[model samples]
Structure formats: structure tokens, C-alpha cells
Target chain A: MNLALHDIRHNVSRFVLTAVGIGLLLMIVLGMSGIYRGLIDDALVVVDHIGADLWVVQRGTRGPFAEISRVPANLEHRLRAVPGVASARTFVSHNVQREHLGKPLRMNVLGLAWPEDKGEWVNLIAGRPLGQPHYEMIADASLGLPLGEKLALGKDTYTVVGITRGMVASSGDGIAFLTTRDSQAVQFDQSGEAIRLERAARVQRVRVNDVGRIQPSFIERGGGPSSSIPALASPMVSAITVRLSPGVDPAAVAAIIAAWPDVSVHTRDGQEQLLAYGMIDKARRQLGLFRVLLVVISTIIMALILYTLTLDKIHDIAMLKLMGARNTMIAGLILQQALLLGALGFGIAWYVGGFVFPKFPRRVLITPDDLWGLAGVVVLISVLSSLLGIWKAMRVEPNTVLS
Target chain B: MNPPPDNTPAIEVFALTKTYGSGNTEVVAMKDVSLRVAKGEVIALLGPSGAGKSTLLTAMGLINPPTSGRITIGGRPVLDGPKPLVDLRAFRRHHLGFVFQKANLIPFLNAVQNVQVALEINDVPARAARRRALELLDYLGVADRANNLPSALSGGQQQRVSVARALANDPNLILADEPTAALDSHRGRQVMELFRKVAHERGAGVIVVTHDQRSLDVFDRTLEMEDGQLKSSQKPD
Candidate 1:
């Protein structure tokens, strides 16, 4: 029989308890890596779903998701005018949090023109698509918004028309789709009280600067005294998503759009790169640190356990040495036990993670490659951890047995 | 048991000495201790608590390096002063056997496995090791308890298992320190007589350290120690 296994068999409960502790630590390491993957997946979901050949945004901006990007809503017409441009859709997006039955829920609200076949609504699991332009919304099923239910946003209440899966923002927020017009109203419409206050503030500004007051037309040009301030007007879109005709090169189309000094353009691959490197990079770093911390903790815990266990068997080690077992043999015994602990722990963690991660609130993606990679890391840790115990065991003088 | 081919003594220690600590704290545990044991002889080491009997035994076992000594076992020089002339661990595994005060059979292994491991370490195949282990256990009269762990055996039975393990490699010399100190007088004398039987029948030399003088009759010769030095030899009444 293997000496290490025989020793562990003699104290089954202690060995099992130590393995359980290491297993729980391994679970966290796996969970941290899974969270990083889930973050990346969630970040790219909208970009992948849009299926746009190119994204056209305001000059000097990354995109609607990574930075503030705005282009004239009418820019879609000009984009369609270009050769090889199959279609262009005006898209607006921003973050929003609303209450449902007293519980707060966050969503990535997207405003877009409908009837585009660019992979939009492709993952709908329930209800009908948004048939009309106003007061209708398609929500991700993760938002837990039931179809046919009314959800309030700003001044208007929108009825849920569809529910889809896997449509989440990089931050794990659900995505909600609405007609551009309704979204504009929700985003730009001012409440009556705010409008009244803003008009008073403007009047105060006109009176203080009396030069415009001397000419009634100049004042009228600005707006009549009680006239509502012409309502803050600007570009209505966060970006323009363009689909190219088949056989059209996205780089060629993007270059043509880039010549518009007022706008910047990116092909689909560029947007994906921007999402990966620009948007989700911070989350990856945090999760990477978390994984590193878990691994370091696991190493220390295993070392402590092995060292203590070795100490418990000090006399046995001395006897073995006295009986002519070489330093290599005794060290081998300790190293073998350490490795067994890691292997058993990994087995438990992998099996439990398979069942537990899916039930987590946020997506936890444990890939096959991750399992193989982590298993290698565990083996390395086992070897390194065994060193402390082996050193101690080797130092035990065989003469101690005589004492 | 077959007799060994050579006529050389099983153990020869020349002026062995062991001292602990340094300078102000220096105290000698053994001083210029010399001894020899021929094949098939059973010798008893009798001493007081601080008489350096253990130091001498440990030095002969090749575990405790002496301050100034030369040790030869089975006609091969094994140690010079505090340094080993050969790989001491390998030499011990191949040519020497040891039994301690406490049976000291590894608690995890059963009686048979305990003996098997000793042989296995000497490059014996596992199947052959097991068969030899069973035979040793039978020779030591513990064959029925071969599968029992050390914890399950009585003190005398455990010592018998330990003796079986010591003989597993057919070593030229066996050194046992207080092998029966924990047993009652009857069991102690039984263990002492067993050592005599092991020495004569197997043609191996045996030296046992003990405080029980009642069992001295079992040894072919007796050596006593006092004040870190050997006294005159004596024969049992």
C-alpha cells in the first residue's frame, strides 16, 4: 500500500476535513475566473446581437457604450445615400434604473427604429415584437418584466411587448428596447415644474444683460418674455448603426463615412475590440486580482495544513528515519499526501461548481479550458506547498527516536 | 536460518565518543566506548538512566554520529569520527536492523505490512516482500495477528512484530534499545528469550539495552555502563 494513502486512511476524518477546506477555496478561485468570463460575454452581447457592419458616431468618440457618442438622427439618410449601404438605423442608448413592485432594477435602455433584420429581437423568448413606434418596449427576460405589463419610464408608461434572453449590458444590467421617439421624450422631455424654473432663469439672464432689452426684436429673436424656452434641441441619437449590402467591404464603407469631418466610423471588428479592451478591461482586472488572491490563499492554507500534519507525525518520521528510510522516501510520503489533497479538492470544486454557478444571480461561465488550466495550477500549488512539510520532515534526526 | 559466510564480527566500534552542546554547556554522553559482538551472540546492555547506553546504541545504529570513532559492520567500514564512510542510510537499510523501546511499528500499517515495508525499502519485490513478511511473523509466533495494526496488538505481541520487522532484511546485526521495558516481567523475559533465539537460530548478532536485570540470564554476555563509559563485562548467574 502507498504510505501516504495509508497514513491518511488512519486519520480519515482529519484528511477529509482538510480536503473540504481546500475544496471551498478552489470553488472561489473557479468562481472568480467564471465571473471574468461572464463579464466579457455580457459586454459583447449587444454588439454581437446588433449584427451591424459598421458603427458611425460623433467624431473623436469610441462608441455609444464606451463613451458619449452622438450623431444627427437624420445622419441615417445620408448613410443610406452612400453606395453599398444596405440600411442605416438611428440608435440611442443610456443607463436607467426603475422600480418594479418596490424592487429596483437596472437596465441598459436602447432607443432605435424598428423593422431592421440586423439580428435584433432574434433571441425573443416570449410575447410579440414592438409593432408600433410609441409606448412599447422589449425587455430582456433577466429584467423579470412580464410581457403585457406596464413599466414606467420618465413621464410615459411603456408596455412590455417582448422578452429576450442573454441581452445584458457589460455591467450585467438587462437591456430594454423602445421606439426612438418615445426614448427621446423620456430622455429630453422636461417636467412642467423644471420648464417653469428654467424659463424664469432665462428671463433673469435677459434682464441682467440689458443690451438685448433695448431692442424688442432682439429680445423676440431670443424668445418672447413668457414664451417657453424653445426646448433644448440637439442631435437625437447616441450612434448610427449601419448595415452594408452583401459583397460590400465594411472597411471601404467605414472609410467613406469617416471622411465626414463631423463623424467617426468603425467596422464591426473595431467595435468588438473597443468593447473588450476599452469597456470590460477594468472588470477583468478586478476579477483577475480576485483570482490571484484566492490562489495565494489556497497555497498558504495548504502549506499550513501540511506543515501541521507533518508536525503531528514527527515521531513517526523520526522512527522511519531510524529504520533506514532515506530522506527522499520520507519527503516523498509528505509530497504525495499534499498532492492528493489538491487533486481531491479540485475534483470536489469542479463537480460542485458545475451545479452551483448556473444558479448564481449573475452569469458564471465555467469553460472546459478553464478547468484544465486551473487543474494545472492546482498541481503546481500542491508541489510548492509540499516543500514546507518536506523540509521539516527531512530535518528530523533519526536519533530522536532513541531519545 | 542459514549461517552467514564470513567469520568477521557483526559489529566493531573503536573508541566511540558522543558529546552534547559546546563550551560551557558541553557534557559527554559517551566517552571512548569500544565494543564488539560476534555472530550468533546475544549481548545485554545494562545501564543507569544517564549511563550513555542509548548514545552507544544510536552510534552503532549509524544514526548518531560520534565525536571520535570508527565503526565497521559486516566487515565493511561504515563511519569515521562523525562522518559516514559510506551512505549511512543505505548501509543501514542493507546491513543493520533496529528495534526501539516502544515497538514503534508504524501505526498506519498492520503487523505484516510493517515487516514488508522494511524489506521493500531494500529493493525486495512487493510479492516476495509480503511472503517473507508472513514467514517472519510466523517465526516470531505472531502470524495469526499479521493483519492487525500495531494499536490492536498487546505490548509483547507488538514487540514480537517489531522483531519480525528487524529480521525482514536478514541483517548481520540487530540493535534493540529497551525492547521490553514497557512489558510485565513475564512478557519482558519472553521478549529477552526471543532475542536469544533470534541470535542463535538466525546466526545474527543481537545487542539489547534494558534496565531489567532479571532477564540478563537470556544474554550470552552482559556489558554495563556508568558515567558515559563502559565498566567490566559480567556473566549472568
Candidate 2:
């Protein structure tokens, strides 16, 4: 006659309802951990996939993810010339929002250095990688764009040549890969009114200047939009990603690059660390605090609930004591009920989370370690919470059964 | 029902005193109380409210230890004054049973489980304990209500299950405090008569502290208490 189980059987509805309430609280706790893990994974997804041995950004900046970074597009040539550097590709990314299917569609547009790097490393699940540079793009499946779908942006329409999955930026937006020149064109695209104003201002400045007066054709040549001048320098990229040759020491090459005054250099791991710790450190702390507060709240609620349950059984406890039941038996009754409640609640959270987590807008990634760690916490909370009930039970005098 | 031999007494308490609050506010709940009960005998302790009949009953049951004096059960000394000679809880589990004013059945447990728990707490094997619980409930004539929780059973039926639980360990001495207070006259007398039958047939010495005088004839002897002391003792006619 397991009294704990028998008692639960008698009040199963209330017990299960109580467990469900606790389960929902536990779900939030687990969800917090999962969301944090997903945040880190989302932050590092591009960094892990880029296959870069080193990153060269603007001097003293953490970028291209944690902060703004800009380097001359031709820096790729300089990086490739360095000893031990096998190849260098220009990296540029910026977020853009456009109306699609009457809903706001946001994406992080990443410029792939074409001819040398044509997004071949992207895990394409549908269609082919960029075959034509300017008018073709590879997009993450999360953008809800199917293969061959054409998206019009900045006076140009790009056909989706390929689709990938799980490729998202730190901001949780889907990523789209386009040629470096096309991306730069889109990033620096100006409205017709702004372009007209800029042209008028350049013409007025040329009329007022001595060089413009002496060489009137110079105004037409130099004042024209920079894109019309093919000999001018190229647009800036966010950073430069370098792949090291086999047997080349990344640290030695990085040290050499670090000596240059124009840019900062970082190993691949450093970029990941900067993204995880620098970009989302406050969010992590906030989530961790919420998790701690929730656990404490859960412990308090369970303690009060168990204490009330013990109070309800006061007379029965006295009767059992008078009937010569040992103190351990009485304590076991409360302790076992607490443990069972925790186990049932955790089971509910685990089972229901499987269905609920996928529906969240952001990924809720529950790892095996997270599951095991939460289970251990639940057990510890149950044991600690039952202490109030056990104390109350032990204080009940057996003579209370009299009269 | 097997009868025990007459020579050995089931329980004996000598000059037992129980008091509450130490200095200045001292209140004696039981004073200089001494009595003996033989096996196969049922005795009733009668008193008004606050007369300490319950105090004496609880003291004799080994639930509330007396402040002073001695207690012996089955010819073995168990308590000398307030101190215990043996492991009191272990001894009580094996040698004594108790019934309260209310059925006091653990509400979550069915009647049989309520009875079975008593045996289980004594380290009795579950199967054997369950079998004995069923037998005791059947003997008490509440076998049909074995699967029902206490709330679902009638008051008389609940008391019968309570009695069965007390007898589950086959204890030598049973103490009941106002066991029939919640039942009507007919049910009250029935519960009292059940106690008498339990005592005479099972050879257990039963002491019942009750306010109801109508069931006096069901006991082998009656003891009256007043102002925390035994005022009189008489064999029932």
C-alpha cells in the first residue's frame, strides 16, 4: 500500500491539473534555454559556413557582424598577395526589407565575390548556384521564396537561382547571396530625386570652380555619376575573408596583416566569439536572469502547494502516527508526492515542447544536455520544495488523533 | 476467536501523571492515574469534556508519555515515568493499536488501503498485509465497502473500517477515543459492540474513552474520571 500513490489516485484530477500548471512554467524555463542556444546558433551560422581562415575588417572594428566595417573592395587583391594566403574574397552584407506577397519580407543581402567565389559553398537544397552574376541570386528557404522566383529590387529584378536552408543572419533574417557588384549597386542605389539633386549640385559647384571654368569638359567627365567612370576605384566591401594555403600558419599571416595600419585582422574563431559575446551578450544575460527568476518562482509555488497539501492531511498524519507509523513513513509520503509531481510536470513539458517549439518564429533548439540539466534541476527543486511539507508533518503530534 | 490465558495482564499503568506547561502555568491533564486491563477484556473510560479521560487514554496508548510513573504491556515494562525502556515507536507498532473520534482514514486511500497502511508501516510484506487487511475488514463487516474512500462510506461503515485498521497488526492492546462520536445512537452502539467483540474474540485488551453512556453495557468494566483522576471503577451489570 504505497500511500503516496494511493493518495494521488484518489485526487488524480487535482494532481494532474497542478502538474500541468507547473509543466507550463517549466516549458518557459526550457524555452528560455532553447531560445538562447538558437540565438548563438543563428549568430554563428554564417561564420561557420563561410570557411574563412581569417577576416580583415576596418581598423579597430569587430565587424562584419558585430559592428560596421568598410574596406576598399580592392583589398581582396592585397590580401591574396600576402604570403600563405591561398585566396581572398570581398565580404559585404546589409539588411533590406521589401514588400512581397503583400507582407514585409526582410533579408540580409550578402555579396558573393563572383568569378572566384560564386556561392558554391552554400548548401543549396534546390536549383543551382549563381551561373550569371548580376541577375541571379541564391536565397535561404526561410525567405519563403521558391526556386526561379524573381524579386525586383533597386531598378533590377533578380531571379532566385538556388535555395538553401538554415542560413540566417544574427538578426534572424534570411540571407540572400548576390554578386559583389550587384549587391554594391543595390546598397548604394539612389532615388531619382536624390540623383537629380546631386547632379544639379555637382554642376553648380563645377560652374563656380576655377578648374571647371578652365576645362569645361572636366565638369562633364568628373561630375558625372561615379558608376559611369570605369577607371575609378570600386565600391567598398564590409570586410575581406581570406582562405589560407595548406600548411600555412593562420596566426603568422594574421600577425602580418595586423601590422598593416589600414585594417584589423582576426582568426575565424575570433569572429565567432565577437558575434556571440559582443553582439548578443546583453540578450544572453537578460534571458539567463529570467531563467533564474522563473526557477525561483517555480520552487516557491511548489513549496506552497506541497505545504497546503500537508495541511490537508494533518489529521490523517496524526492518525497514522498514533497507529505507530514511523516518522520516515510520514516524511516519505510527502517527499514521494513532490518527486512524482515534478516528474510528471517535466514529462509534460518535454512531450508538449516537441510540438510547440517548431511553431515559434525563432528556432527553439533543445539539446540533450539542456534536457538532462533541466531534469536534474526539477528533481532538486522537488526535493527542496517538499521540505516545508515534511517539516509540517513531523511537527504533528500523534496525540492529535485523540478527541 | 482464540482466548488468551487469564494469568497475564495485557496492560498496566502505575501512578502515571501527565502535565502541560512547566512553571506557574502548570496544568495537570492526568494525575496519579493507575489501572490494569486483562486480555479479552473491554473497558470504557467515561468523563465529561475537559475531565482528562482522553489524556489518560492517550497516555496509556503510549502516544502522550506520562510525566511520571510506569507503564507495562504484556508483562514487560515499556515506560518508567516519562522515559521509555524500549524503542517506544517500534514497541507501539508491534504491540498497540489506536482508534480516534473520527474515522481519520487517509481520505485519498480506499478503506482497504487505509487498513493495509498500518501493517505496511510495521514492515509487513504487502501481499500478507493486504490479505490480513481484507480479513480484518470482512471480520468487521465492512468488506463490501473495502474499495470505497472514507467520504463515500457511511459513518458507521467508516468506524468499522477504522476498527479493522486498528486490528490489522493483531495488536495486544487497542485504545479508542470517542470512536462513535460522529454516529447516531444505533450506529454508536454498533461501533461500541464491535469493540467489545474485537476484545473478547481477538483476545486484545480494549480501552475506549467515550462520552456516550448508552453503550456502557457493551464493556466488561467501566471507569469514571473526574478532575484528571479516576474517581470510580465498576464491573458492568
**Each predicted complex: what DockQ?**
0.65, 0.77
State fnat for each of the candidate structures: 0.62, 0.83
Per-residue lDDT for B1-237 in model 1, tens only? 635323559999999989999999999999998988888888899889999998898889988889998999988899999989999988888888998889888899999999999988887999999999999999999999999999999999999999999998988899999998899999999999998888988888999999998988888889999999999787787
TM-score of 2: 0.95
Query: What is the interface root-mean-square deviation of candidate 2?
Result: 1.3
Q: For residues B2-121, write the lDDT of model 2, one tens digit per residue.
A: 464354688999998889998999999988989999988898999888889877877777877899989999889998988989888888888998887788888888899999999998
Which pairs of residues clash in candidate 2, taking residues 3 or more apart in a chain or in different chains? B69-B81
* Residues A308-354 of candidate 2: C-alpha lDDT, one tens digit per residue: 98998998898888777889889999999999999999999998899
User: Candidate 1 — which residues are off by over 4 angstroms?
Assistant: A117-121, A192-235, B1-8, B21-26
Best by lDDT: 2
Which prediction has the highest DockQ against the true structure? 2
Q: Which ten residues in a row have the lowest lDDT in candidate 1 chain A?
A: A220-229
lDDT, model 1, position A209: 80
